[model samples]
Target: MLAASNRLAGAIAFGLALTLGAGLGAVARGDHVVVHRVGASAPAPTPSATPKPTPTADRSGTVSQQRVRHIAEREGFAFLRPPGRNGEVSRWDPCVPIHYVVDVEIGPPTAAADIAWAIAQVSKATGMRFVDDGTTAEQPDDRRKDVRHTKSGWRWAPVLIALVPDSVFHGKGLHADKDSLAYTDPAIYSDEAGDAEIVTAQVVVDADDITDGGHEDPGALGPTLLHEFGHLAGLDHVHRSGEIMQPDGGGVVSYGPGDLAGLHYVGRAHGCVADAALPTDSDDFPR
Candidate 1:
């Protein structure tokens, strides 16, 4: 009777293991490392061995392809990654890295006159000038996970207002829309080489909500452009209020001393390993 009962118990345990989809088979039994043999999508166990941080990729290659010409010495910010929901979560997040790329779209029948007006508006708000008279081209549909549409700073082609049905300026942040200002990943992107999959910004213009202050719009669409440009230019938000990065934006229209330093570092050097030593913007990042 005792032998029969022991056999029955073993059978029950084996059945329980099989029922858990194999992934949970390695039931933890105290200090021992339980090796679960589940499906292919199981979360990777944290390495028990000495953890060496993944080395950032070298960014020497593709020098000619970058968009921003001058990198300033400002602090840096990160682009956000796509969050995978459901069973697909493991395939991403800590895995499917996000990249940073900014693209502007134009509205249809708007023509050169409209784009010129828009550029003039943006330039006036930010106190920057655009004298480039480059040729125009059609914007591509698939602007995500691809680099073909990306144009280097020197090769900027002015898009006509007529070609774009609408226009919106975008800035990089955690959400799909720039309604909130948060970055999900800051470190993973610092490497520079593995940042293509990330999203820098995406904006669309609403005819009703346009403004000259740029901050007048909720997207802060104007500031968003500058903010992302600052990132590309290598500026991070400083902790000061009345600065461009402060919430309830106003007054701080131009890049502060901190902003300039960061921009110089990134635009000129492409990397500012010692950016912390440079300076911090007195204005805080948007809350």
Candidate 2:
């Protein structure tokens, strides 16, 4: 369950609880997410398993698109949407590879590697690419930072994946769950046509939730990262039990077939806009 900013949260309600799944298999209830201060950074990825292995191939660990479709039809998949009884799907104007950064305050020894692994899986499934902006010193804030151009001329805000202590969320007495494995804040932008597009996002995991953090096994942490990034990629929780996008503490560890199908559709959107284009005053995606 990924949680957006306060404003975004207000727009979501029980929707964006960040990455609530943890391979525990439990439907999330009362997804009270902590609205922490904002922060983001970057770095090269290096997991303990190996230098980031290639993303799963069509016939790799991830299920095939055919199977994904079958699963979705049999069970069903969900996309993150704007608040309301209606499930209004929120996707990028045109599906495109996404860039991101990794800011680590704490995590497993293979944290970077775990991130890389998760990236490969998502990229393989959605045909999306990830960019590591190196790293940053910004502290985590619950509010959304306006994305724009930095003094360096690069896009100011990119997706940020951070490993932080629980205190960062708990200390603030944020409304998030105590067993919060990780959460994400994906900034949703609308196009001139009033369609939602996800440009930049942030993912935060409890440093203490992973094996190195005295919670789950080091290897088990990869699934948590994958699930949160899934949220970043515009996925919503499904009632289906054995999926990565299930409720918090779910044990799905990897993207299920249904989850993969939704990702493909999201990545398949038509995005003519620049990956980092700022909304114009003449016409902008509703902020």
Candidate 3:
């Protein structure tokens, strides 16, 4: 869990581990160490684009696309798997719009607006497109299915961001340590060539913590959401202060220069999956 002396200190942490069957799994909190595990599993097939006769709506509501871009970078950033000889960094396909949904059943009154704001922030930083599927009563699950049959049709499950209570948080296998404001579980699959893509993810925020912070105050729910979203975008914790990817919040309310650079590295401007080039050295990764 991301620990802090107080909310103002903005504690956060992230962890990564390999799993069998479907894809790689990673978990993030605030202020924790990252662990990696490797084992052989059949490579999952790459996701193909939605077939013809696409539905106009999904579980979140009417589907619409929103895209933004902000390119910049510097030192003091890191990834779950830094780009270079180690392997390719896993990211969402830039050419496709990422669809997401919010579960606000246990959230504060401002939950919806706060989430929209944070998503926009991440979208701008990463040049990723997002489609809000609106709200759902769906709960967070570590073993959530990657694809589900919806009224529109069968499609990849949209990212789920749930505001959950302590009971649900502990019960749902979110693995949130004590006092963790939020955590993320991202599912990544590698193709035959060893390239990886994040297919779906879950973001679970502690409802009690947000209530205590009143959601909108500095070092409150907003920044926490942003930090977890960073994890969702394939970033891991950095020890540097002033970066949103820092293990602890470091009193930073937004993505710093290093964070922007990291996002750019995984974002559309870097290249979409089909045409994206692999980084060849440590210089391609954040220092």
Identify the leading candidate in terms of TM-score.
3
Which lDDT values do the candidates have, in the order given? 0.26, 0.52, 0.58
C-alpha positional error of residue 160 in candidate 2 after TM-score superposition, expressed in Å: 1.0
TM-score of predicted model 2? 0.64
Clashes of each: 47, 37, 9
- Per-residue CA lDDT of model 3 for 75-116, tens digit only, reads 555565433223355677877899999998777777888888
- Which candidate leads the pack in lDDT? 3
TM-score winner between 2 and 3, please give it. 3
Displacement of the residue 135 alpha carbon in candidate 2, Å: 2.3
Expressed as tens digits, the lDDT of each residue in 119-221 for candidate 1 is: 4433443333345334334332212111112232111112211121222222231121233221111111111122211112222232222333444342334
Q: Which stretches of candidate 2 lie over 4 Å from their true place?
A: 1-75, 82-88, 93-96, 151-156, 173-175, 212-219, 269-277, 282-287
RMSD of 1: 21.3
- Candidate 2, after superposition: displacement of residue 228 in Å? 0.5
TM-score of each: 0.32, 0.64, 0.67
In model 1, which runs have C-alpha deviations exceeding 4 angstroms?
1-145, 149-208, 213-224, 247-250, 269-287
